[model samples]
Target: MDFCWSPTDPVIALFVPTDADEMQPARVSLIHVPNKEELKKKNLNGVRDCKMFWQSNGEYLAVLFNQFNGTRSTNYQRFAIFGIKDPGIPLEDFELENENDMIIAFSWEPKGQRFAVIHALDQRQNVSFYSVIKSHNRFQFSKLVTLEVEQAGSLHWSPAGRFILVAAMRGCGGDLIFYDVDALATLAIERFVATNIEWSPTGRYVATIRTLSDELDVRQEEFQEGVMIWSFFGVLLYQIPRRHFTQFWWRPRPSPSSCTQEMQDVLEVVNELDIDLDNDLDNVIFFGDVDNEDTSFHIIYRATFHLESTRGLGSVVDRDWTYDE
Candidate 1:
């Protein structure tokens, strides 16, 4: 097995990179979380090594594999989709159907049912989209559209699920491609080969770290070893140079946006009450008196007034103090 994890579900999806047979069909195993028992083992459509991906929502899992016929010199690719709820069954399984095309890379839109694939046809690569649908209580997958792109690498969707970045890795000599899902428009910036891509949690910025390869020219080599931050609209925001830089990551944001207004109001009221109680304690005065007895200190009365409260609630504490010296 190459990799395995629970992408958001209780069941674990394990990807076996290759099969025992000479056909080398990629296999995936779905195991139950409670007993660690294998629920289903599925053989994919294509024969060569495969890559596994899961949608962020965990509703769908996709496997992309390459196929080659002995009579043909070109490579062929296909993808299979499995539903998490029905691990034993495939939701959608088929080849690309596009003539002489191979799927290079694909990515799921974060928290969404839509996904994009980078496919190569006639030695040209482009972007294509697919969406999950339900009708008559049966789930189905449908192709939406395709966009022309010069080359393909990896695809990354923003945390907000609004934007996607197409990374052209080292030696591809392709620029960064940014796509806006709602608008169905793409923007490309020239002269960049990204080794790694990271999206800010707020979806405000994208970080692309330059990849160093033997194909880089002297001019490209001079500026190709740094981190560049770009806005979602494909504008160059900033870049930091470091030849040895390897990775870039953004921290996960908190859930403050999901907090309701009423919740915020209640939190504010509680905070105010806490501050009022603290202030009242600070104002409390401590007084002690020595009694006629050999060893005794007496507190005749103690009062605490909550000045911050509108009702001005006050309490009195009284006790006799006696201690052996």
Candidate 2:
């Protein structure tokens, strides 16, 4: 339930219990809110499929949906990026194409220059890239790449738009593939069972959550669902339970100007093996140099959506413990 705002308009996500239909009538709050906003029948028209991308500046959004007419056709091919000249009035809009199927995944190029779309077409999916180019006294889509993928379950773009991550479902034997967008070379391939995927902001790690374990049904054979943080080369770095797969956030490298020679020395002195990032130990980590006169310590901001709680052996057993008289 991630709520986002595009300039003036705030869009809240609506969930569907069945059919995987985005237009199942959900609510829209005035501003982007994480709380429950039930969709009345009137607001159903504004809700569209999952293929929605907010422009880089957050001034506009591109979405696809069906209209009010009784005679219906394919999903709305083109949608306007919601902008606002007046409060609550959806402003700037640009219609692109009539992509026949549902648009599931999309990426806006870094620096708001272009965007890419991935549409679900049954077992196969369509990958289309677009650039904003001058045409007819306005900008038109310059299709850069139009390709197809098999069993395409997920997609992601590198920060600089240099690559795209594709995950495919091939029954019990599926593959996770990475490709260089420009050179068009296969970067890496992996076989970790994944339910969801996200690339780190710095493009150094690809985080994936295994679906089977998240459901927590032991009777199900594939319930070892876990989260794996992998290097760009497909090497696993950190692994946790699916519930531990929280947000896809990366620590920004501190600028050289902000770091003193002492900070560098401290890092060099601390060996990786000596330091423990043990989740099982259940310790709260605070990363910063309070004594550094010129540096700012990074704050671990806990997202309100998933406020994590501490767990202990006693905490677990106490809840289920009982005394026999």
Candidate 3:
């Protein structure tokens, strides 16, 4: 089990299993990080494995749990939504179709109240989409779409929450299926046997790194590592082979304030000015004579002003241009 923290709040959700008593059921704990106070603890009787997910807007928290049925001997996939302001009351509790269905994959939208779940049922897998809704001061979950996939690996949502990537690793020789969330239709598919796939921070690109052997399994003896970077629209950006390639990461883009076109142009001008100033200062030092004993001395004063456009303030820089008799 893993813990998930709210994106815009100080709340976290985690699952705690029973220690020794067979009568005691597992509990999911919602805690406040700053004060370490548990806001709510909900009992899960037959939950074996679970995951915590928070909505990007920080309005709701979802807990996906796999419940074990000891009588019929099967797994049940269920999800529960809790209100952030009132953790004690559950907003919604939904169970997938068929109690024997197994939760193969699940993911939440990166920036919205929508989520997707893939489960195995009736000898095939189905993908279901659900979104949170509010009705008369209460929250409700509405099913958006349910599509069928042949063989799915994992679920990944785009940073912009516009598309979903369904990775197929085992059956189809490693393929990625992209789906449009708004249209609820298939967009594109790319076949690549990748051990890991990561989305760029800015949601512009995704990198798939090869770390597995031809059998689609990770092993130490496997060589001939490779990587493929692709755009969000399924365009192949770059591909290369590397030796002993363990990991690769995209540089996180700076905030909008530091990445605007105007800011970039200003930075370029400042860099050029700095280079020119350095050259001019070097020439001045080489031409100035320190050994001359002249009663009358000439002093050159140079001032560079730094303007903070956002704050409307200016500061001066001293470049060691003072001379005395």
lDDT (CA) for every model shown?
Answer: 0.64, 0.49, 0.65
Best by TM-score: 3
Across 78-108, the per-residue lDDT of candidate 2 in tens digits comes to: 4544442224434334444544566666667
Residues 1-325, model 1: lDDT tens digits: 6655657767777776654555666677878788888766777544557777887777777877676676548667767677776534545675665857767788889889898888786768788887778655456777777877776678889888868887677655676788888777776545677767877766777788765656554365455575777878789866656555545444343477876776576446546444453233322221112121222112213212222222343333332221211
Candidate 1 local accuracy as lDDT? 0.64
Off by over 4 Å in 2: 1-4, 7-52, 68-70, 73-75, 81-99, 135-137, 168-174, 214-224, 227-229, 233-325
Clashing pairs in 3: none
- What value of lDDT does candidate 2 attain over all alpha carbons? 0.49
The C-alpha TM-scores of every prediction are: 0.67, 0.52, 0.70
In the range 1-325, model 3's lDDT, one tens digit per residue, is: 5678888888888888755654788888888888999887788888766887777777777788877777737667788778776534456687775667887777879868788988886778888888878765577778988888766768878787878788875324445787888887887787556767778665656777776455555454533465676767777866656555556554344676667776575446546444343222212211222233332122111112211211222222242211111
Point out the higher-scoring one by TM-score: 1 or 3: 3
The weakest ten consecutive residues by lDDT in model 1 span 288-297
Tell me the spans in candidate 3 whose CA falls farther than 4 Å from its real position.
1-4, 34-36, 69-72, 85-89, 170-172, 213-224, 256-266, 269-325
Question: Which residue pairs clash within candidate 2?
Answer: 26-39, 27-39, 61-81, 61-82, 83-91
Q: In angstroms, how far off is 260's CA in candidate 3? A: 14
